[model samples]
Target: MRELIVTNEPVLISYAEALLKDQRIEAMVFDRNMSLMEGSIGAFPRRLVVSDDEWAEAAQILRDAGLGEWVVGNARK
Candidate 1:
């Protein structure tokens, strides 16, 4: 698995996951708790996680959906 998307916004996280799922790419969200923490105070950019294997695929899935660009393997360069 790999990280498909990372955002403080829950809607973006859920949207990306659903979009990637349509492509058969496994997607997950992490740092969700950080949102609660931030909401209590004030912050942003909470880290999200996905399986390592799905990194490239998930990133591409998001990209294709016009979500945003992400680093993946050679794309990291």
Candidate 2:
């Protein structure tokens, strides 16, 4: 899997997941357990990960949804 978006905003994570699902892309949210680990303090950000083969299309979907700024790493480079 490859990282798609890493963010502190839980809502954005949910929204992105839904968008990806609509596009038939499977995604997983990493660090979600951090909320329990940190006592729901929201300090540790969550990560959205997609399969290696689906990353490019998933990133484009996110970008089209006006979430391009939230993407992380060298996926675009």
Best by lDDT: 2
For the record, the alpha-carbon RMSD of candidate 1 to the native fold, in angstroms, is 3.2
- Point out where model 2 deviates above 4 Å: 74-77
Per-prediction TM-score to the true structure, in the order listed: 0.65, 0.91
Clashes of each: 5, 0
In the range 38-69, model 2's lDDT, one tens digit per residue, is 99988999999999999989988988899988
The whole-model lDDT of each prediction reads 0.60, 0.90
Residue by residue across 1-77, what tens digits does model 1's lDDT show? Answer: 45455455667777776776787765555666675766645266544456777676666666667765533342531
RMSD of each: 3.2, 1.6
